[model samples]
Target: MKILVIVPAFNEEEGLVKVAEQFHGINDVDVLIINDCSKDATSEVGRKLGFNVIDLPCNLGIGGAVQTGYKYAYDNGYDIAIQVDGDGQHNPAYIKDLIKPIKEGRADLVIGSRYLKKEGFQSTFLRRVGINYFSNLIYLLQKKRITDPTSGFRACNRRVIELFSARYPNDYPEPESIVYLLRNNYKTEEVPVVMNERFGGESSINSFKSIYYMIKVTLAIVIDNMRKIGLT
Candidate 1:
C-alpha cells in the first residue's frame, strides 16, 4: 500500500519546506514535489529540505503538473496517489482519513471538501460563489452534487492514477476532471475536512482572471459532457 503525495508547486517558496516537513512523518507516505517551473525558489527549497522534486521545463498549469505525478505513480507502481497543493492550503493531518476510503477499496477518488457542513476556510465570497456555480454545473450534467468542486486536496487509487496519467484536463482542472471521472463511471467520494489558508504567496487567479477562468472551465465541463455522450 504505497502512497505517493504529489505536491504541485509554483512560486511557493515559503511553504515548500514546511509542507514537506509536515508530511514527511506520515507512515508509508512519500512526498514528491512537482515544480511547475516556479519563478521562486520552490525547487531549491525542496532540495534543501532533502525532498524529492521534479522540475518541469515550462509551466504546465496545475493539471499537467498533477498528471506528471500520476504518471510517475503509475509507472513506479504506487498503490495510491494524493494531490497536495504546495501552497499549504491542505492539512496533512487529514491525510490518513483522505486515504482511508481508497485504502479500504471504497472509492477511486476521495476529495477533501471544505463546504460539507460549511466549516473551515470557506474562502472569499466570490470564490465561494464560483465554487457553487461549478457545483451546480456539475450536478446539471452528472446528477450528483459536489460541495467543493474546486478543492485541490484529493486522493485516488491506482486505477484512477493510470487513467489520469494517460490523459487529464490542463487549465483549471479540479472541476473539469471530476466531470471526466464521473462520465467514465469511476467512483468518487467526498469527505468533509477542514482546510487552512495558504501558508504564503498570493493566488495565481485574481478577480479579473477568475471571470475568464469561470467561462473557460464552464465550457470545458460542457465539452467534456458532450464527449461522454458521443455528441462531439
Candidate 2:
C-alpha cells in the first residue's frame, strides 16, 4: 500500500528537521510537508530534509493545511494518508499501530489517542477537559465511544480521503470529522500513543483563545451535524 505521511507545518522550523528525518526511515511511507506560509524556515528545512514539500503561498490555519494534504493524497492516488503534526507533540513510533486497523480493513479512519492507555505526556487540565467534552459530544452524536476527537495524528484510507477532500471544516474540524465519518458509515478507531511537549515556540491557542476555540468549534460541530442529519 502506498502510504503518504502528511505533515502540516506552520512556523515549526525548530522541529521540522527532526520530524521529517524521523519519518523518512519508515518503510513504504513517503513524507509530504505542507508549509502553511510559516514565518520561519519550515519550508527550507523540509526541502533540505528531501521531503515532498508543498509550500502554501499564505498562512492557512491547521485545518486548511491538513485539508491541502488530503487533497494531494487524493489527487496523487495514494492508498492511505496519515496526518502528523508539525509540532513535536505526535510520536512517530505509534504510526504503525495507527495504520494497522486500516490495513486490516477494520477501520477507515484511525486516530492516535494520548488518553487511551494512561500513558504519554498528560495535557493541561483545560485542554483535557475540552477534549473530553468534545469527544463525548461526538460519542453522543455517533452512538460510539470516541476517546479523542481532536487528535491530529490519524490515518485515513482512500474513501476517507475522497470524503474529506470534498468537504472538510475550515477551523478545528477534528470533532466534526468524526461525525462525518460515522454518518457515512465509515469505521473510526483510536490507537494508544504518547505525545511530547512542544520543543520550541508557543501554542497558538492561549487561555482566552482556548475558550473561544471551544465555543466556536462546538457550534460548528452542532451545525455540521444538523446539516448531516437533514435537520437544517
Candidate 3:
C-alpha cells in the first residue's frame, strides 16, 4: 500500500532536521511536511534538506494543515496516511505499529495513545485532568472509551482520508474528529505509544489556551452530536 507520512509543521525549524532524519530509510513511505505558514525557516529547511514539503499560503491551524495533507494523500492515490507532529514529540519508531491495524483492514483509524499501558511522558497535572474530562465526555456521548482523546498522533485509511479531505473540523480537532469518525461508523482503535517531550519550540496551547480549548471543543462536540441526531 502507498503510505504517506504527513508532518504538520509550524515554526518547528529546530526539530525539522531531526524529524526528517528519523523518517529516512522507511521504504515505500513518502514523508510530506505541511509547513503551515511558519514564521521561521521551516519551509526553507525542508527544501534545503530535500524533503517533500507543502507550504500553506497562510496559517490554517493544525486541522487545516492536516486536512491539506489528507487532500494531498487523496489526490496522490495514497492508501494510508499517518500524522506525525513536527514538534518532535511523536516518535517515528512506532510508525509501523500505528499503521498495522489499518494495513490489516481491521480498523479504519488508529490513535497512538499514551494511556493505554500507562507508559510514556503523560502530560502535566491539569492536562491530565483535561484529558480525563474529555475521556468521560466521549464515553458519555458515544459510549466509546478513548483513553487519549487529544492525541494528534494517528493513522487513517483511504475512506477517512477522503472524508477528512472533503470536510474536517478546524482549530482544536483531535477530540472532535474522534466523534466524527464514531458518528460515521468508522472503527477507531488505539495502541500504546511513547511520547517524547517537545524537542524544540513551545506548544501553542498554554494555560489560558487550554481553558479555551476545553470550552471550544466541548461545545463543538455537543453541536456535532446534535447534528448527527437531526437536532439542528
What TM-score, computed on C-alpha atoms, does each candidate reach? Answer: 0.96, 0.95, 0.96
Provide the overall lDDT of each model, using Cα atoms, as 2-decimal numbers: 0.89, 0.85, 0.90
Candidate 3 residue runs with Cα over 4 Å from true position: none
Backbone clashes in model 1, listed as residue pairs: none
Order of candidate numbers by lDDT, starting with the best: 3, 1, 2
Q: What lDDT does model 1 reach?
A: 0.89
Q: Model 3, range 1-232, lDDT digits (tens) per residue? A: 9999899999999888778777777677888999999999999998887779999999999999999999999999999999988978889899889999998988999999999988879988888999999999999999999999988899999999999999888877889999988987999999999997787877777899899999999999999989878999
- Give the CA lDDT, 0 to 100, for residue 225 in model 2: 78
Candidate 1 per-residue lDDT over residues 1-232, each given as its tens digit? 8899999999999987668667766767888999999999988998998778999999998889999999999999999899998887898898888998988888999999988877778898889889999999999999989889999999999999999999988878899999999998988999988988888877878898788999999998999899988999
Instruction: Please give the RMSD to the true structure for each candidate, in Å.
Output: 1.2, 1.4, 1.1
lDDT (Cα) of model 2: 0.85
Best by lDDT: 3
Candidate 2 segments exceeding 4 Å error: none
10 residues in a row with least lDDT, candidate 1: 17-26
lDDT (Cα) of model 3: 0.90
